[model samples]
Target: MNIVVIGAGLTGANAVEELRNQGYAGDITLIGAEPHLPYERPPLSKGLLLGTAEPGSVFAHDHDWYADHQVDLRLGSPVTELDLGRRRVGVTGTQIAYDRLLLATGASPRRLPLAEPSNPDVVYLRTLDDALRLRARLTGHILIIGAGWIGLEVAAAARQADATVTVVEAGSLPLLGVLGPELAPLFVGLHREHGVDLRLSTTVDSLTGTQVDLSDGTRIHADTVLVGIGAKPEDQLAAQAGLATDNGVLVDARLRTSDPHVCAAGDVANHDHPRLRRLRVEHWDNAIQQGKHAARTMLGDDTPYVRQPYFFTDQYDLGMEYVGHVGHAGYDEVVIRGDADTRVLTAFWIRDNEVRAGMHLNDWDAIDPIRSLVEQGTTDLDALRDPEAALPVPSG
Candidate 1:
């Protein structure tokens, strides 16, 4: 079979590797727009930007791994068009036919509308090159325009590099949309404790030279500006191919797109998750898990993708791992096991007396127990609130 994967990110790389591992003797072609080999993106904002991680350490596989595995690794070859009828993908002056195709195109960082379109000093942390560029400019006053995960992480990295960092967020608290107002303060405190200047409920009105005009009638000068508002999924290829797309390429429980021969994974896939319903997750774990699942499904595995969503972040002394899914409505009751002020706590979101989601801040050991509670639908709020409470065993 001619299997063509239209991305060389974590998900695309994993999909091809999983195919080979599963003993698929097919012609696999992995195409990436970037010149570099497939690499993990999470480190770009944290370790790489901080200069703590080596450049090659973030790669999914070494350069020679593809040749040794008999997989065609095409770098800097972006698919320009997709001919669904002929099952061919048009690249730069060439086309490749495929019996099966997986779209793991991932996402791109959102740019500020009012900011200068092409400023050498303005950086966006999405790729390895972006990280390297931002790391080089970390010696001056760095202003981040957004208090999301990327912005806060870059803020942490910048502070560690001895750069005066400032984070501006239109929301009242950092990660307010994701963690909600109750838990958002924890992250806000984490950055503040690490000497990051946070300007909350603030919006950038205009960018004049290196100075940023704020909606609050204040102007701040920054040597460098990093925009980390959010990201939009890369689903244009799928959409142009007549695939169903809303927020991303709409896929079924098995990651199958509108066309049976086509499937999608990673950030580009708006999958019909069993637990989260129709959702698109942009996380490292999701990319790996969904990639493997997509490969298995392509190989005739009928198993559904039902794994709970998981994500993590590291900032200064704080490390957080979150499990399960809670929509924008927020959780009913947030139960804390340890002291939040102490910077070591496990917060569980309870809905209808059942654990819906949980976050472990500076307490990594609680992830397993928290996952158990979420999976078993544990309802004992008193036990959940106790740090010493044993995780309930699942009853068959």
Candidate 2:
């Protein structure tokens, strides 16, 4: 059988490696738009941006890794169209046949509708090229719009780069949409402690030259303006191929798209969760695990993607680790494992006296037990809340 996996992000790369590991000896093709080989992306905003890691350190595997695995690696060639009827993909101008196709094409940065499109000062980061461009333009007084993870991360990197940074968020607080309003200030404090001029509950009315017009009739001067308002999934090809789509290309619990021959994964594919049901995740762990599952399924394995989504972010001195969706409506209380002001804590979102989600800072030992409780839905709130209690036993 011939397999083609589009997009060379973490998901696609992991899928290819997993296929080989799973003893799939059939022909395989991995198509990637970027000229670079499969590389890790989380470092783009952290280590790579901060100059702590060398340019070559972020790749998942070197160029020769693909050839050794006997996989056809198509770098710098982007698929423009998907012909489902003929089971072919239009890459650049050529069409390639595939017995089974995996759509892992990741997301792209959102372009703001600018009143003045001529200004070349606004920048967005998603790929290596975007990071390189942003790095070159980093100068004094950088103003970033949005306080999401990317915005906050860039702010951290910009400050480390010795550029005066300011982040403006339209929400009441930074990361409220993701981490909840209560926990948002922790990140806000993280930025402010580093001397970032964080402006919450504000919006930029317009951008003219180096000045940003504010909704409050104020103007801020910026040497560089970055918008990290989040990204939309690249589902055009899947949708055009008549696949089901919501926020992303919709797939079933098995990661199989509407078309049986097509499977999807990563940020682009929104698949049903085996345990959570009807839920879709866009986290790093989800992408890697789901990609592997999709590849196995394509190789005729009947396994469903069942890994609980996980993600982490490192900013300044804080290390955040999260599991499951925190603070679901059914969750009635949160158990704080440690004092928030001390910069060390683990917050367990409790629902019906069971641990639903776990968030920890500098507490690595607490994650596994809490994760077990979350997965099994049998956490004892009383024992968990007790600091003296031993870590909960792993459930069956």
In model 2, what are the clashing residue pairs, if there are any? none
Q: Estimate each model's TM-score.
A: 0.97, 0.95
Q: Number of clashes in every candidate structure?
A: 0, 0
Cα deviation of 59 in candidate 1 (Å)? 0.7
- lDDT per model vs. reference: 0.89, 0.83
For candidate 2, write residues 23-140 as lDDT tens digits. 9999999999899887777887788887787769988888889999998999999889899989999998899899999999888877767525567788887887777778776679
lDDT of 1 by residue, 235-270 (tens): 999898899999999999999999999999999999
| Residue 168 accuracy (lDDT) in model 2 | 87
The alpha-carbon deviation from the true structure for residue 135 of candidate 2, after best TM-score superposition, in angstroms, is 2.5
